[model samples]
Target chain A: MIQDIMTVAETAKLIEAGNVLLLAGDEAVLRQLPKGNWIGGTIPYFISHAEGGLATRDRIFVTDVTGVAQSVEIVERDANGLAKVYAEGPQEGFSVVIIPALSKAHLSFALNAPNYKDFGVRPLIGWISGVHLDDLGKVTPKVFNGVTGNALEEGAVVLQATLKPGKVAEVGIVNLFEQGGGDILTFPADGFSAKEVLVNGEKRNFAAYIVKNKLDTRLPLVADYYGALVNISFQGIDEVEGEVKFYAPVFTGIRYKHAKPVADYGEAFKACLENKCQLSEDRVVFSCNCILNYLYSGLEGKKTDPFVGPITFGEIAYQLLNQTLVYLEVHDV
Target chain B: MDVPSMSRPQWTDLVTGKKTYQLKFLAAKILLGRLVHSVKENPTPANIKSCIEQVYNVYAKNAGSPSVQEDLTTIFG
Candidate 1:
């Protein structure tokens, strides 16, 4: 029934099937509207039922965000030739985008071209959040879309689309060739890292060096599990006790910290406390796995550098963060 | 409410309007990318340098991230 909604269109096959079209809006609007065959496939109706009925009662509402009337439509044809317009709209806000078929196969492409990743992937969820319904009165497969916001501009490339765990799948910015596919970029991290770690005979406090230079705002680690908590927790995994190689942050020599020899994690902590260790803007980065290995095994046997030995997810995170102020300047995106 | 005076701003700061929150998110992800790439790739001084800079630049694009207001408050406060 044509109600308070700004616009709506029903399927044409139903009308072509010769079913008498009778519709009512809410309980008290009191007028059963006329139903007719599709024009170019769209069942176009004006917004009168919404004039006084529940429409004015604030049932279904659609607000314009870009400060313009957004177009809504029910397209019957997938391609251009059959391009049947089942419905069209400037639908009222707070309304349900009701669909005819509630199936996993139900599909609709957005014309807005939104990018959620740009808004931190949080605000973008609004585009994909809605109830999908079908003629059989059953809920279809829920789809969840993880779109990289940058590619979701007015006419950018669509990146990803898919179904989610629940019956509420959503897809956003179907394109993203410009953002990642173009240039280099940078950002910040909470920097979950240990400031100081004690190997066998040496102790280095990367944290104090960072704090000394007022760069510790993002650093978040005290005595981490690597150099200090190793002896007690891990025992057999002592593969990284020899020739440890640290991947220090070059920082263009901005903040530099001196690497030293200490007794253990305790000594590293004590040295930091006693010296009021200052964060060095010039810094280097190393893996805690190596320190953890040394802490557990000590210098009993020859050790090798894992930085050159193996790779893990954590190592990747560290390297990328080290050069966060980077760029590859591809202007095309 | 009267509309605020600062309606329009430049693009540089506008892109990173939420720099603080965005950086952290990108930082973690960059690190992941680095780890994955380092497998067959040998990380040396020149190599590490470019990798560091590349990852940094890539992640910096996520302008509006969590805790960014706090970071900006610290930087400009």
Candidate 2:
């Protein structure tokens, strides 16, 4: 539940003692730390006590989990085998993960991790670490496992915390967008690629469908997955292939029944931060917001109140998400 | 497509629809990402100074966060 920034030297002390910690900081700072009982990723942007957003290269955002981590596991650089970490996660409590941004393992875990949900695995909460100013799309994101001191550029590192016997951890997602009135669109096949999708059952090229309807590309495609709002944010519409791609893969079987229109991001986000939160700000143990929301909502210099953490490239709450906020709350049950 | 080549203000100019649509989309997208963090735990001058510099660096590189830019001006100016 610890959320605060510390100097690289101070952070090194936490890592040196083999204390469970989750970290976000500059590459140089993260690289210098003495690896111990911790897992971390690279990111300069964060939601600190300061208004809006702040970036730091000198300090590291440390989430002290020294007493909380009952056990930890590191998932090696296996694309398809990434989900195995969750299978090996703490069964009695919850697990958190840190995956390198834009890695094959990140996409692989996103596509397959949801399967573990049905098996009744412990809640999975974490984010994809990335670099700032990634406009040219040249990103080199990394994840760290202090236990092994592995500063991995691929695969992932997971920390499965078996809360104190009387303690419980619950995962929550806060999304403001709902299905808007539009042609029901869904891809014919799964994976990140979609050439033609059923637009009310009539096949149409995904890009052409978007262009034809003049859809607000900023708004994500939302599907109600058993009452949970699953969002598939658009990456771009390739004119050459006439295909539509999403930040996270949208499985074909999900049958995206609705298009969630984009709302006034500032107001919607403010409200979600204030009212939609199931757990009070004081009770929030760990939370992360999608980078899409951070960029789309103009979050710089704005306060999201109690909901704060690293603004991540992607969010994982059992499944990958876009333009949404995911949080972990521990309750003494 | 030539985002890095364009100046921050030029890229942000698209947000008003006065510039290219692609740049506008990119600008709006980048500007919207807010990094909300609480520094009450360690509000030391050094921390705040580094945070300001970081905010400036992010904005200077991307030129999307005008609010942060204004904050930087207020702090340093």
Candidate number with greatest TM-score: 2
Question: In candidate 1, what are the lDDT values of residues A27-122, reduced to their tens digit?
Answer: 112111123311110111112212311112112222111111122121222212111111111112111111111121111222101110121121
Docking quality of model 1: it rates as incorrect
Residue A126 of model 1 has an lDDT of 17
lDDT of each: 0.21, 0.66
Instruction: Give the per-residue lDDT digits (tens) of candidate 2, residues B1-77.
Output: 11232234532332222332221111112222211121233455464444334333333432322232333343233
Instruction: Name the lDDT value of residue A144 in candidate 1.
Output: 14
Question: What DockQ results do all the predictions give, each relative to the true complex?
Answer: 0.06, 0.01
Q: Where's the lowest-lDDT run of ten residues in candidate 2 chain A?
A: A114-123
User: Residue A64 deviation, candidate 1, in Å?
Assistant: 3.8
Q: Could you tell me the TM-score of chain A in candidate 1?
A: 0.15
